[model samples]
Target chain A: MIAYRPREVIIEAESWKDPATAGILRNLPGIPRRTVADAGRISASRDTLILARYRGKFLKQCQGSGAEMCCNYFTASYAWNCHFECTYCVLQSYLSGSAIVICTNIEDFLEEIGRTLGRNPDRFFRIGTGELADSLALDPITGYSRRVVPFFASLPNGILELKTKSDQVANLEGLGHGGRTVVSWSMNSRRIRRSEEGGSSTLEERLAAADRCRRWGYRLGFHFDPIVHYDGWEEEYRDVVRQIFSVVDPGDVAWISLGALRFTPHLRERLIERHPGSRLPWGEFVPGHHGKLRYFRLVREEIYRKMNAWISDCAPGVEVYLCMESRLVWERSLGVAVRDAGHLSDRLDAAATGGA
Target chain B: MNITDMPIRDIDTANEECRISGELEAPALVRSLRDIGQLNPVVLLERGGRRIIVCGFRRIHAARTLGRESVPARVLGPADFSPLHPLEFALRDNLAFRPLEPLERARALDKLEEAGLLPETIVRVYLPLLGLPPRADILESQLLVARARPGLHHCLAGGILTQQSVEALARMPPESQDRFALLMERIRLSASLQRQVLGLLRDLAAGDGASWGAPLDGEEVGAILDDPSLSPAAKGEGLHEALYRRRHPRLTRARARFRERERALGLPGAIRLAAHPYFETADIRVEFSAPDAARFRFLAGELERAARGADLETLFEVDE
Candidate 1:
């Protein structure tokens, strides 16, 4: 049993350099070292175990305006800074340090989610908790999705997209996913996974997990968001698509989202400072309509055209969409533009609900 | 005025220990001299009892330009063997006021060698400090072309080249020097064949040249390439598509997918667009109005005309 304190005495931790977790600690801003007693509980444990719980607010939703498309999904929790140190993560900019934040109030989070879904039962909300941390990443320590998915299954109007880059789906093996919850994986080409994304599951491992989830009557989705630009990228992406279709049926997938590499300006600086060798952050970019720097519109269209074409060939009926792109981009690249944000939401809802 | 303040006798050019004491005279050199003093002193050497300059010719010119009566100097032995002594000194002197190209350096060296210097002597005395092959290729190539004929030299220097120009040069009864110059110019051949012709041309001139390559035979090109009137940017775009198609023949099915969609929608004939580098890899999802395509086509057209009129001058200018 652990002692719990809501408000603790504040102490500044100057610097933390533990050999066991030195790799992750070095890249963060210097945190002054100090100790807090029973003021607020300081949970201490082994290097692997994460301390967390159900929270007050589970879904952090961002709704799009009518003119823009709403591939805008929700991030449930703020904590869980990744241990993987993937060069592409947006967390490096958002969080001050690598220390994973595990919310101790899980039941409270689920209750809030229950109220939101209850209030807007008719309006479809596609939400997920794995935005900051890999959704199921800290499963061993927190047993998060194990606790949340069952509750999510009870809610019929909304679907939970538990996205991850981890092969830790063993926790969900016997759960009644009921094809209601979508298990999505953010995938990259094998070379990218090997070079840029550290501590993430290999392409084959993620594919195997996706295959397993499909066999167990779960709806699966793949996100090629942050599809990095590199030499020989076309063949590499095509090979991943081939591997995907080979393992799971098109019907098993709710949708596939293609997004070119993009991030907030602050995130770009953090990525470069932390991962100096990362070249993806420094590609040809211009400020887009949304004010975030994006790859030139032409570049986005090119990536969309190639990947959409490959997906259309491999899995003929799977719903293919762009994540957080302009209507012009959609029309120029795919010739399919949602007339409005509502229509975009309707299409995703339809795909998720109709999936086997 | 004190007589002692005046400079004494002009130093003997052939004297190894002789020194000159006046500052450089060129306005820029004088200004620099006033601000920074002389950083590099002139070097002179004696050969056959005549003063020969081993290096610092431009410094002498600058000092002369600045109206200085005499310049400082160190006389070297005829057999001096300092690595990079001559070329380095020569480069520093010539490059002080104006940036000099390798070709121009070759020309300068050519004149000096013609005045009775040996390449072997230059190599032994100056080439050692030029470092490995990476650092030496440009200088060596320049020297090699300089020894060749003017046509070959211009060819290596990226003079106007076309199939016709190449054939004309090839057929010109082989003069050894001309043949050598043409040989150097043909280095651009491999790049052109890979369809990097424009890039090679851009590299040739300091600015993007207004035009390059074989002059378009309007009829032959009309039959093969896209309609030039539609847009040069579009045409330039077509080149990328052509290259992509050439590289990945598998994208044919992908093209078919787009064609089928266009046909089903009852849209007009699809506009030929450039293939992006990632065209075959990622999903292309687009939604836009008719006005967008038209606007994009017009922009592409303007870019194409600019591309068509490209010269080494515009291509190599300091980009904004």
Candidate 2:
């Protein structure tokens, strides 16, 4: 994938005091930079990069935290937008303005995270930065992965997962991550990647990047979330599973998450306007109790059962979990009764620690 | 601004650069003029050696229809209206009296752009003033609505099309827009049904700009539309059902099978068994309304009888 080059950069006047801000700017050598008193008010386009100080808590509960059977995962949003223009992306409707906003106060974010982990030494927290943006898509310019990998390396009670669909893994090498960071990718069939997920790395490129992370002594993860249900999907998805097993060791894979394609009605309207050609939202969709449009219950059960079986065939006894699915679905598909959010979290935490 | 009795002939009514409304003839205004006379003065701009209307196109049209040579009006010359376009004056004049319709709003926005206002300014400053959100996409859609075919304008004037449907209508080719307008006239669609039919049409296309054929294309639909025995409302419903069937053939077929199986069970009239929405789940719902305890007991016995029968298994089985 081509590296992101912002047409323009807007910096919050107060953000210049942080050293990470200068480092980020140094990477974007001659881009036009404008300093504003308030970066929040400036309307941003996709080509404009806004460097602002994140005033709110840098760490937040994942948006899917409200699910009945959540993984009890958390999100640390050092950035607020993405560079990829995936047609089914929720951010197109969730976020305003087209600009990719990056929080420059990384040091403050790390300080608060360290304190939060220190307070809960006995609990395991699985945090990621991919909820709002592709975790490593902007890593080349921001070098955020380099700063984040080592920070989690020193901690014992937490694991950081960098989920991405980009191949920007150069900065991740030669870092003392200490086996704490799990660099993952959002995998889909090659057809969906080419038609729906614009600018995202190809499946081959993503698995190759995952292999590189494995060789770097860091753990790896793969998420099959938002798996589209279509004709000939079984063969393509099964092939993807086989390719993933060929590239990296399942022992080093911390967790593999499976979720069916879903979105809100509001996001569907945005898709109609922004990506008019996309037919991903057209299906036998029913509104879930949580306000997201999902495939039929039986349809979801079939997808999860097949995907779980395929993954198990290649790498049996690996950590496989669901993201924001219902307890009934888990029971019917995975055949594991996950009682609630806390129970599921415990299961994932054990997986994160390699069956500790 | 100056008020005067200018000749109707002196004003260039043929030109429409400053007009903010699409209404051409106002019979009601003509009646009002005949009954009580003009209550307010029309606004006009003196430009290019003739007077151009800034506001009150309907009022002027009514006066002309009533055979009046002139009417009382407010005329703004070059010095009086500066730092503002004539379209704003027309917009303010109408907005002060009443809200602009969807077509008028579109025209006002198009005129504002034609008057040299930047798109950003229009989105930020004018959209809210016109009671719309400051979104460029909204602006673009509105512009499409404003410039849509004349037949669509007639449909829009009838006040049946929703905002989504209006945009969809505008995006179609001119011939399609006219046929869609005619079909809409033959049927009265509720807001929800309108979206469903149009959404199905939109989804049928594998990509954008692909033709959905015609709304009255097939022989079955054409017969339904042409059938004199069917009322307009029934025609609308028939069109909706046909489109829904096309959009979800598998689901519709499965539903027919479920209904057939349900009828074969021969439960009492008081009891009803229904499948889940979209037949998404294997669980079937049993509903029975009872006014008294005795009725409830009888219904319960009937329900148990049905459950013990083997046909209950078929009711629960979904056609995958």
Candidate 3:
């Protein structure tokens, strides 16, 4: 695991007064701390941490472009940015500031989730905490999962997916998740993990952790998202798929998602500026719906077709879906298309609930 | 610090020291000279017992055009001036008045480096003063354009060649740059087309392991360029299409296969079958225009029938 040491911690005056903030501060004993009147005053830097209260709705729908097929998944805004620097990370463009903002008002966040789940008891809600941040990269420091996992376990129809690229699952062990919380890893080929996913866990470490999660009675998920197209990608990805089945049983895996490398046009310039000498932006791209740049249709279809074939060959019974893809792409790649977001939600719910 | 009126004939107008070119007379400045007289005095340096013009070449020419026997001048001793001092004065004075053309900017940069100024110092201090980016790459690109063949420099000054296009051309051999510049000038290619052609040439050269001129000398390229009946635009379009085919042979075959499959489908002219670019996508888009409900219903029925045809799958089949 990559050790994360913030240069300094800037706490909001109100947040510093919270008891939870006091406990979090005690975890990082030697880090310098200063109290700020508001989180806005603290400039975000990669090495700085800002503990502030989150005032917005904690549960938000994933802002998928309506033009594409959406999985109808929701996200909980527990944190604002990630510490790991993936070369094509959208956070580099989405977040104006760099400071890792961890909302210290856990009570308020959990209360909102409880109220939301209570209001929709009959609705199957699949919410993830890794949209804006790595769900578990900083969990060891904050131990927020201990609070979130149990609350989700009590929900009648909601499932919490703690997606991460780190092996910080020891805290998650022994928690009474009741098989409601899913531990997912944002995985890539070993070659990609070493070169592109900087400061993230190795493929072996992540698989080992997945095995641990399986043993702990939690469902498992894997995301092959932002899959880069490079030379010899077929062999590399085939090796990764082979390794995944060898490490864990196919029956334990809930679902796997495939998404190609795509980004907004605004992120193009930022990628070049932030990661000079990066070949990620050199591929041929066309302007897609919602202003995102996507690989040529043929290129994306070929990749998906190959990946789906390889994964199905290994784990024939496991569910594989496309994330934020068009209906045509879904039909061409997976041989089936959910009617809409609601239908997609139903399919995923079945998979997560072991009904698939 | 002597200010006196010097006869226009006595001033060395043919001095090889001056780097500024093009029309020396500006109508506004000439109008000012004709109306209010010379507002600023021209600087001169006494060299070889003759006064060489240091700055204000335009003002002197305007004064001469206005039938003035003499113009206000400031004479400085040669002892205080170095060889580059006059060029420096000319550059700074012109920069204060207006933005310099690309060639003029290139010449100023060249003179600065020749005068013992480091490229780093030029990029930091002088580039911004000239309204250019303070980057070493920009400095180097400008220097390359400045040092290119005279025809290429003329094209740069004429705004026929963009900085990006010139930079790309600069990477080629001098002979190739000259040939491409001539071709571009003949075809009157827009800045965007210039870039595309240069990119195609570079890719073709790299793929073929030949010189840049080899692609230009191809039979298809020569035929397109020599087609006298075709308009320049038509020739340009034809050349780009041909070069694109050469550069992406696989994509060309895929496109040809798609066209053939689309043709075999025998859909109405109003109905268009389009595939994702490079066949990188399996999605085929069918578009048609319907003027009324009946037509719309008919088109929908036709599309439904076409979807059931076996040839529809061929449209999505690509080599990848």
Candidate 4:
């Protein structure tokens, strides 16, 4: 994939004191640069990169709508959007003229994580930075992984996950992660990886990166999220599952998550208006909880059931969970009954904290 | 504004400098002028030694229809349009009595551009004054709606067609637009169903690689609408269902299979069983209404027997 280089960089004046700003300027040498008193006062496009000090809560609860069994996941949004224009991305609806904003206050974000862990020593938090933007897509330019990785290594209560689809693990090499950071990839079938996710890394590049991280002594994760179904989806996805287990040892993996394609009716309209040629969001959609559209429950179950069987066929006793599914689907497909959010959270916390 | 008696023959009716009205055929105004005469003065603009009707295209047409050679008129110089643009002047005059129709607003905006106002100024200043969101897309769609075929005028004005639907209908090939207008004339769809019908037709057409109106030309769809035994409402419903079934054959087949299984159970007429919403879930909904205790006991017994029946097990298999 071609690398993304911003045409212009607009930095907020308040971020001048932050060290990340200096690193960003040193990285993008000779690029056009302009400093504004407030990034929010100016309008920027996707071509422009705005660096501001995000004053909002850097650590927020994973907006997994409470209508379903949530995985007690927390999201830290150091950035606002991604570079790849996936056809089914929920951020497409959040298309404000304010382009991709990167918060330069990295120290403040790390301190917030530290304070939360210090406040609740008994609780194990599985915090991720990949909710709004890919965690490592901009790592080469931003060099955020070098700072965030070793910080989590010192904190014994929480584990950090930097999920991405790009094959940019060069920056992650030789970081003192101390087995506290889990580098995960958003996995998909080969056809979808080629057609829908147009600008990300290839299937080969992603698997090769996962193996590289696995050999580096970091726990790996694979999320077959938004697993699109088509005529030969079963065969293709089965091959993808087989390929993942072949490269890495099961013990080196953290967890595998499965989520079917889902969106809201509003996002469906926006997807059509923005990307008219993509038929990914149009299908047999039944209104799930919270007014979000999802695949027919039976279709979702069929997918999860087949996927779980395929994964179990390769490696037994691996921890696999559904991302935003109901309790009924969990029981029917994975044979794991989730009573509520806490039930699923405890199960995932064990996996993240290296328990049974 | 000063009123005067001006000869209608000298009025430059051909120069529609500010003709914001969509239709000039005013039957009620003509009838009123025939009975009680003109109550309002037609506003005219003086330009190049010619008089142009700025806000009274319909009034002038009505007076002409009544065979009145001269009529009461308010003649103004071009500078008199002032603080407000000529299009705004005409729009406010029309707005004083009733809301401007969709085509009128579109035409008025078009004329505002012609009246030396920037597109940005029209969007920022005039759009909100006209009760529209200050959006370029809304303006573009309204302009497309204004240029729709004359066959779609009554439907557009009668609220049968929304701005998006009009835009959709207008963007079709001229022949397809004619076919859809003819189809719309025969069957009336509800507000909720019109959007679904348009979408289903577009999807079916795209999937089949045919014209946008190709499905309406089919014999089966035509026969459903032309059925003499069906009421208009039933025709609309039948057309929607037929389009939905064709567009989603897998879902239709699954529902038909479920219906077949439901019929074979031989449950009482009062009891009803339905699959989960869109068959997305494993749970089913069963509801029965009973008036008396005896009737309730009978329904309970019937439900239990049917629940244990052999065909009932097959109903749970909702997959294709």
Best by TM-score: 4
Docking class of 3: incorrect
When 1 and 3 are scored with lDDT, the better candidate is 3
Model 4: pairs clashing at backbone N, Cα or C within 3 Å: A297-B280
lDDT of 3 by residue, B119-139 (tens): 898999889988889999889
Q: What lDDT score belongs to each candidate, Candidate 1 first?
A: 0.58, 0.84, 0.82, 0.83
Candidate that beats the other on lDDT, 1 or 2, i.e. the better one: 2
Location of the lowest summed lDDT over 10 successive residues in candidate 2 chain B: B206-215
Worst 10 residues of 3 chain B by lDDT: B16-25
Q: Which stretches of model 1 miss by more than 4 angstroms?
A: A1-56, A63-67, B1-320
Candidate 4 per-residue lDDT, tens place, B67-98, comes to: 88988999998789888766678888888877
Candidate 1, residue B113: Cα displacement in angstroms equals 54
Q: Write the per-residue lDDT of candidate 2 for residues B142-246, one digit (tens) a residue.
A: 889888887777778788787678888788778777878878878888888888777777665433345765434778788888989999888988988886776
For each candidate, what's the DockQ? Answer: 0.02, 0.26, 0.23, 0.39
Q: Residue B255 lDDT in model 3?
A: 83
Q: How much is B191 displaced in model 2, in angstroms?
A: 2.6
Docking class of 2: acceptable
The local lDDT score (0 to 100) that residue B242 gets in candidate 1 is 46
Global CA lDDT of candidate 2, please? 0.84
Segments of candidate 3 deviating more than 4 angstroms? A273-277, B1-3, B7-55, B59-153, B163-188, B191-254, B265-320
Interface RMSD, prediction 2: 3.2
Model 2 misplaced stretches (Cα beyond 4 Å): A7-10, A25-35, A46-48, A174-179, B1-143, B160-164, B207-209, B214-223, B226-228, B249-261, B273-276, B279-285, B313-319
